[model samples]
Target: MTATNVETTRVVRTSWLPLIVVVLTQIQASFAVNALTVSMAGITTDLDTPATSVGTAITAGTFGMAAFILLGAKIGSRFGTRGVFQIAVVIHGLAMLGVALSVSPTMLFIAQASSGAVIALIAPALTVFIATNYHGEQQGKAIGLLAAAIPAAGVLALLLAGWFANTIGWRWSFVLMVGLALINLLLSFRLKRVPAQPGLSIDWAGAILAAIAVILLSFGFSGLATWGVVLATPQAPFEVLGISPAPILIIAGLIVGQAFFMWLRRRAHEGLPRIFDLRVLATGSERAVTACMATMLFVGTAANFLIPLYIQVVQGRSSIETSFAIIPYTLSIFLSSTFVAYLYGRFAPRVLATAGFVVVASALTLLAFTVRGEWSQAFVVAGLILLGLGQGAIVALVFNTLLSAAPKQLAGDVGAWRGLVHNLSGSVGIAVASAFAVGILASSIATSAAEHPEISDELIAQVNLDEVNFITNEALAELLATRASGPELDAAIAVNAEARLHALKISLLSLAAISLLAIVPATRMPRQRAGDLPEKLEPDDDDLIDPVDEQEALG
Candidate 1:
């Protein structure tokens, strides 16, 4: 090729490099932070905290993230992506450092919640970068690569976190995060500055309301296990499978808050943006995004949340053993996401998406039925693969669809909404699944206890709590090992097995139903190949505004 032609191609290709770095760094940070879940016990032990309290700290981080996601978008829009990206990275670094240095549970919670705020800022800006710099197949591939990196990084991080925690403690885990944020900060410099477009105004009220609604919704959903129902009733008006109303009200309130926000957006002025640009959600493709997010959460939660419970409680596996068992699910997501991105252009998205959901639903249904005493690792691995494949396809496809469907300038908005929905669904899925499983297990325990009066109080005490039921499975098995020789031990083991099987079945059924719901939205995904959309509809200079150069704005 002529030098002139070669140089032109290089320029075009190089334009995407900055965005690529941003995506990679974002994934790295996400993976590192989330890896903490696997080591939550370690964190609580080091800090002298209760497990439930530690979970609350983690949930606070999530609420903070959901609360500020839109604000991050607006910040990115005002300040160039470059500036917002840089600031977010710095804050994230500081937050990690703070967490590492924290001596008390209160400090740790504060630091983690603060870190969530920075994540909200950085995540949206990074996503917007992909939308603006790339178009067509390139854009789809970019989004896919970014999405794929998350699970891959997560698997890698989880594998290493155990060793890291063993060697230096959980505090050191955040130290690693600090280093990652620094790397992200350095790489962020190469990103092109999004020039500020005049006439853009922040909708303060809309942003606040949006943040409040999401925070309330997430809080309410997360509390489902503890609170049971949302409303106070005379006769358990909102009982689910015999559970009572305080928890469900949170879900109801979130729905109502969203409706009010929609009303606000409809009446708001043109220049100011509503929390969610309802117009974006009005599209068929957007429906695909919503479905994809919810589906991924459903599948991922079923695998991540329940498998650990099943293994630790029912199968009596250790955390390290459970993590290894889950490797296939994580790795499958990485592999499938990578493959699907390349294939998205070659095959119809609807076909791939539909097939993906089917795979997930099938695997989950099998899990419901096959969960028995002495199950093979092979069966679990196979199920994990199907789950991963389904989620990988959905995540990659949704990222591509949502960002592409959104206006370029609003990439941050799209990214925030996407993250919010995905994480929220995941949180809700786990909560609901846990509650369902517990309800079933509780019923089993009650029935079995009535029939097996000889069961020791010590054994019954261990069975009452979910954590004890999970981590002490082998211990429980040992306690009942003599059952092979006597009726007393035999009865106890039988009851334990029955309770576990019931829990597993209930959780799996819920997952299967959620995966089916995914089918409805996946069918609405855009059918065209990349680059088919009009250039005017894509992100351009008019969509963004450079942040006012104020020193105070620096995080």
Candidate 2:
């Protein structure tokens, strides 16, 4: 059979069970990460660490994924893709075991980081294998299932982690992942492995440079609040030209990031091996798909960070409470993501993407107005549902476009690019949300305090307002007693609470504006009519492969 014929009919030759196994990999990755975040309260309580430390583990996981994903792609191409994938799965399961038995915050970080690194390879391989194993409409449906796996995992994570963490503490939630991972490993055997390309070379220098750039960038963004956005804060170890090390690292990372791209360009010109083949990213459709993914992922990640943080810290709730709070959002995401796939052949990518953003911005605006320290309204829940629904649709559509549009050989490259955009955006989302909200909270408190007569100017001056961070009402009450008492204290608490609500509202509004601006790029997605695919997709169309040189040229 011709290569095109093999590619087109591969799925018709296989049992449907392997398709389900391919999707399970995605579910396991998301489930492990979400479980860790929702169980933050339990983790802090068990480990005797501050709740704020949970962010570190989350960031660490993103960093691991971002840094190693390209390298993981290369590794997959070098080794037999399926064998390497299976090894990564087993290692990831072991890492989850380590997380389950973590003795300290450091151990948890170590384990999660390892898991992130390994899954980086598996994520790309999942897409590549699906394309390799399935064809035509089956390929399209398989990609949709992979995309839906993201929100589906959240539903499962919240359900399982919430109950497990509540009953036996948070440690066992990760232990549960170990079992899921094992099941995935067993199911993975149903899938076949491709031949290894031992002759393929890696760009070690490019890999190192990219890793440094992303690591520095994510670390700087994560530490913006602690190390100061621009000026030197007390927490900062040193200053560069009287500016904080945080921004300096970010600047350095940008420089290195540009250099890394330049290095890739040079490598491609010289016809040497490269960590990432940038040709997949050269097309308009691919770039647009990437932008759409990054933009939506950023907003979604911020919401994910803020929701759990609020439920656990502000409400002093456990993992179960956080899960219950987010159930509506998760379920909405699942429905939207799954349903959007059926529409792929009905609506233009641009139209669906634009409508998605509109819904997202409107939902965010509603949430902005409805959110408060003690706020609970049916509309707020309704808004969250809308947010998930819209966000999920965009994720599915953009990713489906990306996978179908890019050539089959660059499927791994596209997957690596997807991982890079997603994990980095997630890291940036959490960091931006944290810094923006905290900064607003401190400023709003100072401004609001001056207006309230009971909160004297002298009292405000006595407290180090800039140093204040978000904490529980009980924690705030204890701290306030050290400074003032009686009606003054009551007045201060009320003002602080109000400031926090305003801060959260402002942050949500900012995200809403961002979502609105994202509509511009969403408009740029291929302007096709109902049932029309983007032009870039023709090269990889399973049913109509032309065997042209360009179709064969893009590894």
Winning model by lDDT? 2
lDDT of 1: 0.65
- lDDT value for candidate 2? 0.79
lDDT for each residue of candidate 2 in 1-555, tens digit (9 for 90 to 100): 999998767545455776787777888788877898788888887897655567767777887899889888778767777788889889988988988999898898888878887888788777767766666666667777888888889989898898888997777878877888899889887777666765677789999999999989977887777777888778788988879888998998999999999999998788777787777666655677788899999998888887787778777887887898889999999999988877766777888999999999999999988876543578889889999999999988877666556555565666788888889898888877887888898899888899999987778888786576777777778877878889999998888777777877888999999999888778667532222222121121122322213322221
Q: Estimate TM-scores for all models.
A: 0.81, 0.90
Residue 322 shift from truth in candidate 1, angstroms: 3.0
RMSD to truth, every model: 7.4, 4.8
Residue 34 displacement in candidate 2 (angstroms): 1.3
